[model samples]
Target: MDLLDDESSAGASNAPEFSVSELSGAIKRTLEGAFGRVRVRGEVGRVMKAKSGHMYYDIKDDRNVIACTTWKGQVSGLGVLPEEGLEVIVTGKLSSFSAQSRYNINVDTIEVAGAGALMAMLEKRKAQLAADGLFAPERKQALPFLPEVIGVVTSPSGAVIRDILHRLRDRFPRKVLIWPVAVQGANCAPEVTAAIAGFNQFTPGGALPRPDLLIVARGGGSIEDLWGFNEESVVRAAAASDIPLISAVGHETDTTLIDFASDKRAPTPTAAAEMAVPVRLDLMAWVDGQEARLSRALAQGIGQRQQHLRDLSRALPRPETLLNTAAQRLDLWADRLPNALRAGIQSRQVRLAQAGLRANMLRNLLTTGQERLTTLDRRRPAALTRQVNTARRHLTATTGRLRLSLLQQDVARKSEAYGQLSRRFTDLARAQLQGRRNRLDTLDRLRETLGYQATLARGYAVVRAGDQVITTKAAAAKAGSLEIEFQDGRLTPQMEAKAAKSRKKPDTPPPDQGTLF
Candidate 1:
């Protein structure tokens, strides 16, 4: 038994050798080869979309769970995005990532598993959007009465576009901008969303005119075919559009999320066009009716005014009848005019005589005025003298009432004030004089301390050659005569030498100036 065990161990060791990477690669190839493509039906588990645009999720049944991955490029093509607790069918190939050493399905397309699942998702999404107020009635816009340019969002090759164009032509024709887009399938939502946003981006009066109105139309279809319009992106784009939009995505019985979010909803594509504009024929007929009514009203008004004018003419008097009374009065005045002139001449003569008498009265008044002026001149000097005498008497009376004691007291107070002021002035003068003396003494001391004499007394000296003081040896050498000064006296170089000879030692004090003299 021991010999067999050793042989079996040697056989097992020689069987094969593989690194971890090689082993994982082999398993990956086997998985992809065995199940090249598959359709998986299960309820989606946790769904996570990375910032890198890759989607990672799980599909699970009663006990088994399968990992799934959808690349960024493939994500947009998905018919129904996987959600937690939603049953879906995913189509892709089975593959294994060597780095993770785990097997997963590389999902290419995903869709709701059944009608029940689709309806459940739609209801869930509808509730969420309603909660966000995207479906609020207040958000709806009023469509233009007549749009100058209409932008249509629909499949270019579909009957829906043809129907809309035909209906618009039959109604009030307008400039139409057709934005071709896929109406159904995985590309539907993104294309429709882009179309809506693109239409709104146009600048008004630009090279391409911006649409006053937008129509998103599609022929009648089942819920599955119309599912793209129910996408959150499509619904939000419709809701947020600045241009007034009319959604005609399905038949009258078919409803979509866009219908709720759009500015208006039409039962069919053709119906949306009709709502966009009024009937041209009807508009012209109404205008003609209004013009006719205006003309008839204008003519009736003119006729009524003419009849009223005739009635007013009957009440007015004739021109000749009005002038007759004035003419008769003029003739009567003409007959009396000469007599009135004669009386006026007599009256004027009487007035001239009265004026002559007034001239004499004025001459008498001038004489009286001259006499009065002379009298006033004579009285002026006497009145001025009397006023002056009266003022003198009043002053004498005022002086009589004065008290001698009060006057004496006033004089005493004045003298006391003057004496006090003089004392203060004398004290101030003495202080000022003392301050000046003190300052002068300080200045004198400062001067003495700074003087050369004071420096010489402190064992220093100033050498002099005549008026110039010799400070350096070079200056002394250049001088005609050199003099050296000690603290006690000034000496010529010859005298210094003689004094050194006479001195007992070099350290001896110099002779005094008085001694030198």
Candidate 2:
């Protein structure tokens, strides 16, 4: 046996030998060459994230276990972070760490292995959050119609933030405060939660403007990438936010726990901006339409009033026409009275002459009468003249008095009628004027209530791109620039380049554009 060993050693003296590092390196190369990039399915175990931003974990099946490491750069993009006991599929390259002298996988990506396990976990979390009353509809707050300051929790460098800002600029330009945070990974949840709480801490009207609304946004990705939003801390923070919060974590189909906790859930980041403000041109056009309607109503009312006045005038008798009949009657009475007196005097004279011619005995009477007549003849002329003059004077005096009395009575009657008619006309005019005034006032109030300016006065704002109003996120994105109109003034905010890039991944197609005016 000794002679055989000596012969073998002599024969193998020229053979190459390897050091520990060399052997390890050779083994690593061989493993990489054989497997290259591999997909390993297993249940996660003993996961630990290091302070150096690297992740260390174990993946094991019932019979075998393998160690895995994900560097910080790859961790951000990993759709899901590994948790103990979670079933997952890890894709990575097999390599050896010479210092540790052990083989491990350098993970490139990780994802939930099957839909069933993911759903179970999601259901469990959802049930827990529901039991906590975080998903109750009554717990939600109302979003502002227009926010003066918008707070955003997202990765400042990611496309999600850019998309949100761009959408806001297009919908309504507002002051935006950014709280940079990790969108995904172990650190993502706490940072997001802290950001939400920090925004609430800002004092309103202070040097640092407080947010009226908060937007927790992220771009569309796989379930793992969006898992941070489903974390209990993030969900709780969203539910507890004093400022109204909007969750725009992913595409419409991707829903997270935060969606239920938020006041509103936007299918996409851009959609959140649309929910914030109204189109400026559309509002102005609506105001103009209301004004025109009010004017038409008032004009029609005035025309109706004028027609009523004309009808009233036609129904009333004319003053001059009524007085004419009274004047005619007075003239007829004046003409007949003097004639009647003259006829009575002539008849008496005729009777006296007939008696004188009757008899001789009457002749003595006649002779005496003649003597009387002769004696009276001297004074008769004077007496007759005096009696005629006295009768004429009395008749003249009576006629004058009768005419004067009739004139006064007729004048009084006509005057009283005129006064009554005047009073009635005045009352009618006043009533009509009052009714018109009331109607006009009512119309004015209606106009004010329906006007867009009134809405603006109630803390709303309008958004415009150039002369056009941006009614949708797509339209705003296409516009590239925008103007926000408030009750007091207009603002145009500068958009970042990141926002432009985010427009490329819109979940919905752009809507048709139309003129507001």
Candidate 3:
């Protein structure tokens, strides 16, 4: 306590505080241990990367921000290069350096975060609404084919109101009333619901004119900021409305639950306006078109009637003498035949000459009948030919009987000889040959029983791998060809099956060898 304590106190008083380098090292170590791996999301700006394997950037929100740094090695594998003015989420070890007396995230991963989560949330909400029948085509009330008074629900001061108003004014400014709404933030749901209710209700003074169609709309924003239209109350209010609701919320790509529940969805406020009112010019054009079509139809009808009248006139007949006309036509044909025949007779004289020659030949033959018979009698050789034919027939009959008698005697001798030879033979040789034939037939039948082609015909199957027949369990040890044989042909199935290991046969004891024991 005397010398050493005094000296120690003096040293403590004189010694400088811990160096900045030491403090920084301690802080970095403490932070690394405290927040090993964390995820942070913020807007990115002023991204500066050092060649010494370090990256620096500012992580800002709407109100405040902080400088952030990530070692190059940690963020090298991130597919996207860090850029200014992109909202991103960074995951890394949290570290602090006492030397600089500052803390930064040592980013390990980085990506656009809100888009994926927002997409997922939107998809979930859409699915829920779809299941609830809010998105059913049946639930979507058809827009009054010609809505008279269109109602508008949007921000009173936003560009959306101006856009909707401008479009309505330019196109069909006949009479539209915009029911102002809080389209963003916590109060959005209640405000929109009330606006819709007010339109639907029977209210008195200060009430906006009743609208047959209500337009619910907004401009595009971040998913969170645009989430008010996706709220349950807003959707229910839209679905409950008797007045048809038209939703023009956000950009074309932006989807919300209210869009599904509403009667129709317009991509933007301007589109909603267009949908709510028919263009004056377009209506005028349509009226003209209808008028033209009516004119064309009337003309076609008149022309068709006139043509019908002309056809009837030509087909009609007066009460004149139809019978008299038919009688005259018949009498006119009766005197025409003889004249027709005379005009066709240029070769009749040659035909008459031939007829005369045929008549002369017949007369001459009749006059020489007896002379012709005498000449035939001189030509005849003898009448004994008939007798010769009779005697030859009798001789042939006698020879035939003799031949039949000889044939019987020969057959009797042959039968006796055959009986003697066969009595001395046995049936054993014939039976043995027949048994061998039966065995070969049995083997052929077995092959046909299990053959792949035969089995296919029999409505059975054989799964084969390559060229191998796969006759036994051992042959199909590997999966390969995968051919599926059918009745018509074989097909290689796109899918393959692993070869199953057949169960091993139980081992049998060695044959007994104790015969001499």
Candidate of highest TM-score: 1
* C-alpha root-mean-square deviation, each candidate: 34.6, 45.7, 38.2
Q: Pick the candidate with the highest lDDT.
A: 1
lDDT: which is higher, 1 or 2? Answer: 1
> How many steric clashes does model 3 contain?
4
Runs of candidate 2 exceeding 4 Å displacement: 1-115, 298-517
lDDT of candidate 1 at residue 470, scale 0 to 100: 85
Q: Which candidate, 2 or 3, would have the higher lDDT against the true structure?
A: 2
User: What's the ranking of the predictions by lDDT, best on top?
Assistant: 1, 2, 3
Clashing pairs in 3: 23-98, 24-97, 24-98, 24-99
The clash number for model 2 is: 4
lDDT of 1 at 114: 89
Clashes of each: 0, 4, 4
Clashing pairs in 1: none
Specify the poorest-scoring 10-residue window by lDDT in model 1: 399-408
- Residues 1-517, candidate 1, lDDT per residue (tens digit)? 9999999999999988999999998999898888899999999999999999999999999999999999999898787898898999999999998897788999999988889999999999999999999999999999999899999999999999999899989988899999999999988999999999999999999999999999999998899999999999999999999999999999999999999999999999999999999999999999999999999999999999999999999999999999999999999999999999998988876765555555455445545655665575577558656755665555555544355455545556756765576567556655655565555456456555655778888888787888899888898878887776776777788776778899855587887667554
lDDT of 2: 0.82
Residue 346 in candidate 1, Cα distance off native in Å = 12
